[model samples]
Target: MNRKIELLAPGGDVDAIKAAIIAGANAVYCGLETFNARNRAANLTFDDLLGVISLAHRYQCEVFLTMNVVILENEIPTLVKLLNQLVNTGIDGIIVQDLALFHLVNKHFPSLLIHASTQLTTHNEGQIGFLAKVGATRVNLSREMNLAEIKSLTRYAHDLDVLTEVFVHGALCIAFSGQCYSSSVSVGNSGNRGRCSQACRDEYDITAAGNKFPLNLKDNSAYFDLPELVDAGVDSLKIEGRIKGAQYVHTVVDSWRKQIDKFVESGKLLSDDSNLYKVFNRDFTNSFLKGNLTKDMFIDNPRDNSFKHANDKSNAISVVQIQEAQQTLSSDKDAIVSLVADKVSQLSIEKISLSLHFSGKLNEPLTITAVTKDTTVEIQSAVTLTLATDSRIDEAAIVKRFKSLKQSEFELLPFNFDGLESDLSIPFSQLTQMKNQLLFKLTKREYIGAVTLPALTHYPKLNTQPTLSLLICDEKDVDLCDVTDADIYFKLPESFKVNDNKYIDIFLRNPRLIPWFPAVLIGKDYLESVRLLETVKPKRIVSNNTGVAFIATNMGIEWIAGPFLNTTNSYALLTLQERLNCAGAFISNEINRNQIKNIARPKNFKMLYSIYHPILMMTSRQCFFQQTVGCNKPSIEDGCMLKCEKATTITNVKGISFAVDKQKGGYPSIYNHEQFLNIDAVEDLSHLFDEFFIDLTDIGSGSKAKIDKVELVSHFENVLKGITESKTSLKQLVTISTNAQYQQGL
Candidate 1:
């Protein structure tokens, strides 16, 4: 049996969701109040999400939650908690973008379904293969693909046993997926973070030689063509208006529903009698689906108003006129006139006969007997008047009198005449032709025009002036200089000792550090332990994942740890002055460059650089192993064992299981040990006297594990030489240290 194509619709609010479901949608993708792509939609809360899940499941429809935004370092805890809650609520699947988040979820909640977000911009076969390797079940193809490309992609993906989904109808974005920079450049907000301000929709002017050109509107209409992306082979059809109103939702859903049904019933897509334009539409086009989209596809034009007032107002008018030529009418002659109107209603002819009287001989009017046309109507008392001119009588006076009578009201003069023709049709073909031509030209022009920026300068007449500010910061506090110049200091414990039997005491102190000063201190004992035990630095260094957590708490490094330091054991004390200084420095640099400034802090510490493996998802807690149990099972497929879920486990020498979930829709997990050897140096550790601690979180898993097996005293000599040769910059050191500490929860 052939599976019916899935119809997916947007549910910005409850009503829209209900409407879509009633209209026969197979699935609905929506966002929760947090971490959803649509930040502006009065999105569903946790309760609402649960409710929606129940409702959709009741209808045998699947509900997919969108947690597609990039996860920030600080937001990991909240995200993890949310994921746990969502899993417990029986949500069918999640759509996500950040790889780290993907890994985290796959590691912790492996049973949950993961769908790769379109924002990943997977366009080619290589990208698809990559996603497949990472365990992505379905890939939402980018809207920019043409029909042939989609067909090729679908075929390729099908061969790999991966499901492919495509967008069929909705608001079309002007930029390529994952490649749009318009929002960030215009508003200092990244669309990847769900903070886009829709700068693309604003009106702009294209200026050359100081003359501004209107790029958005031409001939009083928007130029962009809304695409309808249906094809016979598409697995799912998605609509794109999550921010639109319910009316728009209803109309679009209804129209597309009809189209899909008709296609299913008859294998025909478009209908000549369909009222597709009655829904919310800008000029309709096939987009790049057919091939290279022409200039006409981008044309912005005036909106059609046919759907505004649900009525037809076109009416017709009639005009009647009489013409005559020189000829004397015979006594049997009668006059008739025909009037034609275009599609007229309530039409009636009040009178249709003519009368004539003659006065030539005795100053008395001579009554006519009859008037007929096509020998049909006879006027018995009219015009027995003949065209013969009496030689004795005055012809001019009679003619003049007849003309006066004819002109008096609705009368016709007795005159010499020719044959008459009636029932002429009105000409409306010219008007119809003109209207169609105008519409076509306008649509074409909009697609060909380039986008422009709008002018928003203040006018003096309006009594308004634009205000702007310039800011600057000092360099010393921004970690641009060496640690000493920034007035930040670090000290290790007098004696660092590490052994498997005893907990190491590697104290970190920053007595002169000011409050809020950004600094990191990695104890030699903890670093050496990770280096020897894990062999590779953990991808993230936080209290939850490291031995440094207890050490940082005992040493009290919280104050000077600034924002990046996650451990509470090893603390750096900071003064209020240093905090202000760092902030000032960051602001000063931004002001100089005319860019948005970032806050600053202390200079030296340990740093980790990503080497060979991709950083999957970042999280506040360690949950990957717990989520892998149910995910790693093999399913019987075609008499072969196939991994149905994205879970993989690597056992350590100690026989501890480490879960690796490489699913596409969830957080991505990094592997291989090559990424850990890039660390260059450790700063502010000269006091340790030729002994610098190496943190394994800065290296690959295998490397960290290798480091764990060797004692610092035995390998110290070669490690020191390797560190010096690495040419690690102060920034790189700090980056690795901060990331390591964060992962360790230090």
Candidate 2:
């Protein structure tokens, strides 16, 4: 028989867990108080987790513990202890974001299944294959993927014996998951670490009338796409909210449960998502799953809005909302829970075959034998039944007594005393006692299965005294970067000429030149360009995608990972080196300076110190300019207006400015308020980085027009020399950024 798709639910607290089980979820995934991505949620304690596991198991459901945070080096000791303690807690699987969890868990407790979190930023088959080879049983594909992408990925992952999971409902991030850094830049708190300030929900001036929420993508509800996803062989469908209250969770889960059941039976989704919208939602966008690359995915005029208020900006929910929702759940909880219990109590799975030996004589004791799938449990009552004068214990009466197992978790298979009289007298109280003993013995055993993990063979080495480099966006900007005393790192934009050799001559002269690939490539065009550029054999290759890592590994070309791959924790950094064949990496810019310090890998491991490029707030396949001006294409050549070349500014109501810079390719990336200039602070961490790079893609000092080649080269040259010489005291230094606290986090 084909296994049905697992109905998974989110459990933020004990109440949510119970509600999910009651709502008919086959499995529940939740986080504990420590080492989870939802650190801000009311996560469970050890005792709470134990209770949750026991409760879910009692109802024939599984519990998966969340350890999806990118762990720091210092946190490893605590994590080790936590995993060891959780070994016997009846946790069926571990949902993780860090590679170290794979290493540590596989080394010690090999029985648990590892799930790769969405934070890992895996989009391609290469990334998914790497995780599966390293021991990921299931990989949660990125929510940004279209249906075609999901189908292709699911097919590939299935070949490798890995299950695939996707998010089907709830809020969607404007930026890609794990690739966003707006929170870190705006609030000095990292979203990857679960302290997001919801910077995307902030209002930005998209029109002259008012500042609208342009960066906020509409919440996704792929209810109608369930059939297609099932056809694609998806193993699980996950709902997005964990911080939401129990009533919201219960309603959502119940709705999805009914919808899925109906679809499975009839091959179509049931109508009515009214309860879904009433509870909470941002209208709905099936764009990602539909592969609909259009601007309508966001809330435009605000008239047809799905949700009126900002329910996402803060996870610290209102007291009234919580109390109100709690009441709704309280009134309905008993009915829902009773329905679940009745359904569970009727399952024949809890039944065990029983063989009995009944003594017909007066003083002989009765022995009952019970057999579970793997074990045998036998019990005998201490009290003996006395023979009666007028009556005998009938087979029908004995079977009735044995079959009355309403309160027990086990059922005894039909059995008869072959040689006994139809009316043999027996003590009724003694018979009841024997039945109780049999129930306890058969239902209380835990799984004693052992899991073996593959041997780990790769280790990373650190590179000390890292050098300084520059990111040149175009050939025109190459001259500006050439005069600098640092190693020139050319950034191949997503919109490079398909068959041009104009930039090859520039890098050919400098063997030390490192070429940085765009974090995102539109379609396969730029990637094809990179394939053509490979004839030049770039000495130091920089990749942000694992597909590039695979090419580099096969060609024996040395490459380093960029943060677009989401290497927030040390384990991710190590995974790049050991598994992805990357030499070293640029730590995620989302992390604070303290996290960077504690994330020291092997000594001398190359860690990039990027002195703030135009920090990409978010990127999209559809350009907003084209959306407003009337165009169907994101590229300029496809009958589009060149809105990016003109003055395009979106300021928040608070008067903060954002520069919209659209690329020639389909990708349109939004830059932060100012050029991330953190010169003064780099001095403190100078020993940590062997190389520091200045980003000259968007601005020169303050404005885009003020880009003077000579001034930039001279200013950085002085800063680079003055760190050691101390005498260069920089005659032409730009003023230190006043908002240093935002850039230099503690």
Candidate 3:
């Protein structure tokens, strides 16, 4: 049998947690005061987190802690400390998005179950497989995935032993997960770092010739469906509300509980349940889950007009009838009675007086009077009529009798028609009088199912284990060693100039930089014409970028990058090859582990174990200068400001600013000043370059401006190297840079 799907609920506060547990939820996801996606939600403190976990555990419900926000370099250390505290507190699992944090958790707490948060934009099978490989046990599938897409993903994940969870209810987002720019564009806040201001929910207008077109005002309601998603069959059903109130959570949970139970009992899913609309629903449309939604789905009109109509009372009446009856003492002489009426109104009846005349051998017209409210309505005739004493009758009979009462057209009451059951017994006369009274008091008591105790799973005391893997490499010049059974190659330029030879200086400074050389050679060179290289003799030469390679017939020069320069070629051919090599070489912004992989296919690349800091990104354009208007010194805490001509803005989160360049195809550009000086971990390249080179001419530097900035960069690079060298399992890496220099004069 397939595993039973768990119902995951949201708990913004303690009350919401209680409501979720009481309403048959199997698990609850919550956030703490810091580092959660819902930072604005009144999140739990450290004590509250521990308390919630303990309480949820007692009830046999799993509690998932959300630490799913993007962290800046300076935030990493604090986050690591918080993660350490949480691991000690015995959290069941953690939701994460940041790759560095993921690495940190895997290194420090390998046994901890990691869930890929929805903000990661994990839409396809390839992304899921990648995440699973990196120790993500479960992936919260993107909200935009349709039924067919979900099924396809589930099938693909099953083979890999990864679980797929999908959101089955709650508010829907207009943008794709992790792809939203509304927050930054509208409010200068980064949504990826948990500071969204919900700009999508705001109203907007399109205008032409001074005439405004209200794009979202047709039906006067938001159009997203929550009910249809429940039938999609996810491994876990998630309700999305961390900032919503407890009442909203309770109402939605209760409705879904009843709906799920009804579906299970009847073996059919009902779509037109009007009760669902009462539970805080918008105009329902299956957004993207069915297909690309229509323009109607974008309607953002308020439901104010519908509120007036909602207050309008319906004049329709509900009528129920008694179909059969039998005596408890006599089963053979059973009498079947039916009650009929035209309308039912809102009125209470203390006693239902039934007038019944029995036709029998008594020779006297006998009227049977029965009290329908307190005692069983029995006919008092000499010839007795048997009644059905089925336990299902008492409840049903009251409902049927009350429903058959008629009222004036203006006195209509909203009745729960489905609440009436089919099996009921009532005296023929009492059923007739019940039409006049809307409310009936029955002698029988209402029976609600007893709450069964949940079987609790005993979670063992968590034993924190070290989670980092250690790799060691020795520094050795393999090129200078024996060339036995080795294919040697060198990447060389066709011509050289001493005046303009920075690329040559960098290459000569670190000839054994395994990954950097490969990356520079693989891509098309952006700037190669200015630099020149002299002819070099080698057995085989390869060219990369726009530069050419040269090889002599006898010399053993192995070209590691760019197009191949054969030994059969002459001197002029070698010069042409060098120029061709320049076409494919360009410098990368910042080098990371992933970039290293892209560079060289080494069996085992050595990492620099001891270093001060690391740089995160490199750009041809100056990001901080663009944000600060005219490059004024701004205080570090005040953040950098970039004013754009093409309606673009940048939000600086944790020292990194995400600039949406409207002039540059709206591609997101990440800018950080500290990433340039970090030393990459390598086994045998210490002999050549003593420091990483950073060109800061674009920022128009001075001692006051460049010193502090470079110092911060150097610190991060060294710290990264130190962590690697110490072989200590690191939970996080943080880089700090202040806007103090920019704020100094202000």
Candidate 4:
């Protein structure tokens, strides 16, 4: 942004809001009760939001409410209620992830600005442009981007009249935003739904490599990149810690504020007091900023909820100022009491009354009584009355005389002052002295009330025996499925979604097979696609998103949780099995071998682990092929369907090629360049998981060379049969693929 850069901080609660303000941030982003990415944080209610907006406005700061979560069909009405109440609150904007929420807010509450959440996985201009067309005022770039990628997107956004916001400090996710499935697969709770278990923070034990703590990524700190980010035309510099305590928020905000000011004046970073505000960071990494895969982004010791310590030393912040915030918390009866008190104190107000009186005699007395809300102050004044030589006081004059409550405890209200004679002589100067008596009493602070949140958890156990699942794209690939050994699932293409019979016809020619539903048939696509698929009534299915899971459950069909559901932990898997009533679920491709063992399964359901497959890196309605070769599709729903039949391999600066394939509804699902392979450790993980899936979409995805479908299937069968190959022979067939930090960790 060419204008003054806005410093955005997190307001997890009212205390954090105040701390951000006191710490000198230009804007604060917070969640209201529900539907936010960090639902575990102490969110504000409808009433709390009114006071929050009022307080933030009072301090000349903006408040952007978080509506960043995948919308469940049942939660729409509640979301509408929240949006309606938010309209009148004069909230600066909203941070959202769901497309439904974005559309609803844009259509109904035109006054409210929308800032797309990073959970939307916005990386490039095409995605950001898609959001801008939907009325996003700003887009939070994905944390997985390099500086070059960010510069390009920011530049593109500037042309579209959209602002760019990037995280300058925060806990970085190992998976791309909107793509990580580790939490959901493990616990049925979703990162997209704001209940992320942060499985990336967990330790992993790789079978082949000696890397013990593989997935724990170092937190991101682009602090020194302040000037460059500002120069990169970012409209806002953000700090990400809504789940943190107030002192941490204050410390981070204060440090960034000072550094920003220093950058503006000196155009250089601070080296001297660097350790003063060490930011409680777990060793920082700018991995995506430079495409440095060799960088040490993994953490040896991951921080948990129990890790509670704010200051590193006195050098962290100015001593006197830090104590003021500390003392406010210390004054409370206990730790919990202090937290609740801070939330309530945010909207606290003083109670008071104002009175005016007059005697029948012209010079008798004109009395005023002022009392505080608590009755702590009772001031009675009978000022010296002046004799009126000409005109006497009228109703209007009386109202004016006592209405001057500047610096008073009580708010002004309309009251009848006709009991006594208003036609009396009184010096206005006498009224001035009366107000001075109640100054101290009016200046005391008070609070509104504390908001409560409910406890949350996922399901327990459910498991099924192993069934070799094969994911295919065409009718020819379906013929290769050996009915005697494996269960086949064909991913329905965008063209076949409305009429699965085309693929069903092809499948019936060979053998009856399960249908793999689209990963992103959201909104109308969800309703229509589910309607058509129900007619086919396939015995078994693959559930892509939560909506599909609901649809499948309603029809009483057996479903296996697909890779898109993001099942990484045992809790997430338990959630999917018991909550969604799923027969089986796939373990997240994001986790290593030992992490899979941690998710102890239940007896009723089966778990499928992918030993070989191209990991889907990103998914979107904006097709890459359409973007590359011009498509005149007026909206996301049209024009690009047939264009996406041919897969395009997009190569980045680092020569990493991402395979882009479009599923039903013209949505592009991008896969990583290298395939994931762990053949040697296959037999070892067999006890933990039952079904082993090999997603064969890679067969048709156009690359320099294509693998024979028969060979890939046979390779899996051979490994399953306990057959071993030489080290050199294994790499030639499977070992030479990327594990997506299955060893290095993201």
Q: Write the per-residue lDDT of candidate 4 for residues 1-746, one digit (tens) a residue.
A: 22698999998987777788867889999997678888889987665666666567767889999988765434555666666556645678999876565546554667779898887666544455556665788999877666776787899899989999998887877656787654553444567768888754554433122343444566777877776777678889899899876766776787888888877777777765342233356766666555453325655467631112223332336676567544543442244435434644664423235443333345555554444344544443465455566656556665665554422334555554554464466655554454444443444322111122222232343433444567777676666755346777777654434433565465456546677775544334445556655666777788665555666776787888777655554444544555556787776565556555555565567777776666555443333443333235433344355444546555432343456566443555556555666664466676667777877775424332466767767767766666665333445865337554454221
Regions more than 4 Å wrong, model 3? 205-233, 270-276, 279-282, 302-746
lDDT of 1 by residue, 606-669 (tens): 2111211212211101122222232121221211111122444443323322224433212223
TM-score of each prediction = 0.42, 0.74, 0.44, 0.50
Top candidate, metric lDDT: 2
Location of the lowest summed lDDT over 10 successive residues in candidate 3: 335-344
Return the top candidate by TM-score: 2
User: Per-candidate RMSD vs. true structure?
Assistant: 31.0, 11.8, 25.4, 17.9
Q: What is residue 335's positional error in candidate 3, in angstroms? A: 42
Global fold similarity of model 2 (TM-score): 0.74
Query: Under the 3 Å rule for N, CA and C atoms, how many clashes does model 4 have?
Result: 29
Candidate 2 residue-wise lDDT, 1-746, digit = tens: 16588888998977777778878888899998877777667988776776677678877788998888767766766777677666645588999877778767665777778998887766777677678866899999888788888898899899999999999998887666776666666666666677677766776655642337666667888888888899888999998778876666777888999998998787778988766755556688888888765666776433324233323322327877655555554445555555545543443322234455444545656666666566776666575555667755667666767664432333345574654433446677667777766655654433222243332333333444445577765666656544655767676655545565555766675555677775554334435545635767876678776555666666778888875765655666655666656677776655556766666564335777666466666655545454333344533343232223433566676787666666443255566656656565367566666667667665322233445656665666556555433213322242323334334642
The TM-score between candidate 3 and the true structure equals: 0.44
Error of 3 at 739 (Å): 12
lDDT of 3 at 321: 14
lDDT agreement with native, every candidate: 0.39, 0.65, 0.41, 0.62
- What digit string (tens of lDDT, one per residue) describes model 3 on residues 1-746? 23466778888977677667666777889998887888777877766676676567657888899887655434545776676556545567888765455556565666568888887655566456656655678889877676777777777677778777887676666545554534543344546557777653443232221112122222211113333443444567777788865655665565566666665566455464443344344445454466443433443343322222223223223321111111221121111010001011111211224322222222222232233333444332332333346532343444454432221111223332242233333354544443322122221212111122222222221212111111111123233213221122222221222344544554454443221111111101212321322321222323332122321111233333221111111111222223222111111222223322222111111111112222212111112222223223322111121223232223332232333221211111223333222233322223211222222221211111323323333343343345453222111222233222111100
The full ranking of all candidates by TM-score, starting with the best, is: 2, 4, 3, 1
What lDDT does model 3 reach? 0.41
